[model samples]
Target: MGAKTALLAFTDGDLRPRLLRPVRTNPAELVRVLHPGYEVTPIEDDDLGENTYPPYDTSYVAVLEGAELFCDRRLVFDPPSRLPARVLEAAAGRRVIMHGMHSVSDWLGFAVWENGDLVRSLSLSPDGGGGDNIGTPYEFELPFWAGERPVKAPYPLPFHPLVLGQAALRAFFGFVNEGRPSPDDINPFEVALHGFRVADPTGREQAEREAALQEFLRKVGPPRQYKV
Candidate 1:
């Protein structure tokens, strides 16, 4: 089996009007926008470092002309690329949000960062109506100005219905904002979260991995139709 990979979502530069066109719905167009450079590079397995999981080589770089998306090994969307450029454009030079659904624990978590400072984080559990124990979905809006303040008070309600409590949100921001190294620099969480470790992937983990992926999709909900 190939090495496992974690997904990292970010926008590379300033959000431009031209890049804000709605994401194309055509599969070919979608593939083109998603893999703009079209070069697949081999990522060092060891480079994945400590986090929540092993790192896999970036199989492709997905761009919608505005946003940059990446996947370690598997293509999570139907057309192999789902990020709309507008989304990236909206996040450029500001905050980026990342959401993950963990199948092992049926948990959904999300984090927000602005200029590399952690702003918010959240997580949730299945509500019992979903199929196959898929974890809950998570959603949060990040202002482009998130890093202006050192810490913001917790919200009365979770930004998303699936997100359970304030503690997760606090932890998310703390994990990103507290002067930790980048995931590639050293172990990002090493100094921040002392006992945290990335999970080792194994052959027996396939079933659970698939379930976790499904849960992730369920939480991501549906992609918006591209208008332009």
Candidate 2:
């Protein structure tokens, strides 16, 4: 079993035109390709005013503890901020996984929690074989913060879900079996999902994605072992 819930973060809407859309090859044709459905607005003054850490795009996908989707672009939270009371309460005494795509470096990272305490964090990097090199997933005895309060650290890598899957699973399972946190609190389904998300390819094109991931892991070998 693995983490049942996960949080996914993506690029902000305001910078899409310049980052995702505008063809450096042809700037004048930008507006013509724009579609009403594709429009993404900048963060509002009120929202920006309250934000403490550097601004991040609000787009994210949060898979809740009970296997529900909470997709929104306004779920952004700054570093050092505590998980929402509701989110924390729901995750109380349970394992939760938070995953997000880093647009700046096109990397992905995940935090593993048990009984509301973080146990491990990991990120991957490009190994230059048209694949990724899995970095050592850091195991923590207690929840570690990014800057202030204990939080998971994000890593940089190429933005491919398959590549993210391997790193995420290794972290999740490694923490569950060996980290200081106890899995007795969180649901087993959550743990299973951690493995499933890494191995399953139903939603993604099965053959190609799985093949790429397998090839990558085969090259990288097992994650470096640490003596707890």
Top model number, TM-score:
1
Candidate 2: tens digits of C-alpha lDDT, residues 94-205:
4544443333334444544556555544443343212222233454311221223221444332244333443343343222211234442222223211100112224334
What's the TM-score of each model vs. the native?
0.29, 0.28
The lDDT per prediction is 0.36, 0.32
Q: What's the true lDDT of residue 118 in model 2?
A: 50
Model 1 whole-model lDDT (C-alpha atoms) = 0.36
Q: TM-score of model 2 relative to the true fold?
A: 0.28
For residues 1-228, what per-residue lDDT tens digits would candidate 1 score against the true structure?
111223335544432221223244322333334444343333322211243333332333334345533333332221112334443444455555454444444444444455655454443443432222122323322321133322244533223222222223223322221233344232323221111112224433457777898999999998879877
